[model samples]
Target: MKNGPLFFFGLFAALTLSWAGTVLLSHHQLGGLAPFYDENESAAFPLRQPGVAARGQLVYADLGCASCHTQQVRRPEFGADQAHGWGERQSVARDYIFQARPQLGALRVGPDLANLGGRKPAYDSDDLISLLYTGVIPGAKAVTHPYYKFLFDERPVVGEKSAVALKLTGALAASAGSQIVPTERAQSLVAFLLSLNNSYDYPEARPFVEKTEKKEGEKK
Candidate 1:
């Protein structure tokens, strides 16, 4: 207690050690992870994203979607991610090996999208495009999602109305002679969302079942 300099040195050492253990150690463990190769599928896990999906990933980052949604699913014992139909298995580093900038978001305001593309009753490209334009789930009463109307443009129909033009009603309907069509950016963003699939079962992603020994008790 009398040695003030020694006390300060000890405190600094403790802080430095903790940072190294938590931050540096974790990076070292997962930084060089590689994609898992599935023999039956004859392709490596975490398939590379196409050019449009890659660009869409950039858009996703710019729009700060990660602020509200997470891309990772927790282990079954840790949470009900699998039971709730979020994912079949816990997410592992191998799932993001091909991503330029993995969006392992910090929050979970929205559902985990790691397996969105592989969900039952899969959401097709058109479905995602419509959702982005309208912010309304097909049957839901309330429109809780933020509408990305700016992603689309209202242009007067030329020779033919756009095939991709959204069919709207009520206040959201386009003005007469105009149709709402998603821009290239919007299309790419949808592609990115639809590309979010991590359904492959990697060895590392499987749950760890701890073995226990039976104590020599009266009951057999």
Candidate 2:
């Protein structure tokens, strides 16, 4: 019985090493295949001011948020993901070529963020930010999302809603509450999210590409 167990373990180890060697050897070939067969496109609008989004990526990683959320969308065969509109297609390698370390998260506690940039209502970044800070969607039942009030400053409102602010300011002001309000940080994060639109299917991105190509041709 002891010999049987040892033999199986050894066999497993050998097979694992052989598989690793084969994959490593094939890695270059796989990369070369991307630009040829991979027609995946880049995001549409500018979200983060390049530096900020790069920093926000650090935020995503530092928070360990990736543990609970997967950035990639699985195709139809792997699951019923299509019905949810999480993404239109399975994530391909080209989608992440620019990431210094891509965030193909390991689990799915939260919905996939693959196409979240333009997916939300009216494509509103503020609403998403507010949701992140409150986690209580006003009249809706309490949600399981985390509150991120620790990351923002409490500033006075600028527009016509100051009256409601005075009422809530007594209780919900940054000083009185433990929440971060998430306005700017959420905006930054949403900027990052809104940037996730790969134009492979989105009509919104097409015009921008044409305009840019025209400009470049004129320059040439």
The clash number for model 2 is 3
Model 1 agreement with the true structure over 95-159: per-residue lDDT tens digits = 88788998989998878888888887788878777778778775675777888988999999998
lDDT of each: 0.84, 0.58
lDDT of model 2, residue 44: 35
| Deviation from native of the Cα of residue 97 in model 2, angstroms | 0.6
Q: What is the C-alpha RMSD of each candidate to the true structure, in Å?
A: 6.2, 9.0
Candidate 2 runs further than 4 Å off: 1-23, 33-49, 120-122, 137-139, 156-186, 199-220
User: TM-scores, in order shown?
Assistant: 0.83, 0.62
TM-score of 2: 0.62
Error of 2 at 32 (Å): 3.9
Cα lDDT for residue 55, model 1? 97
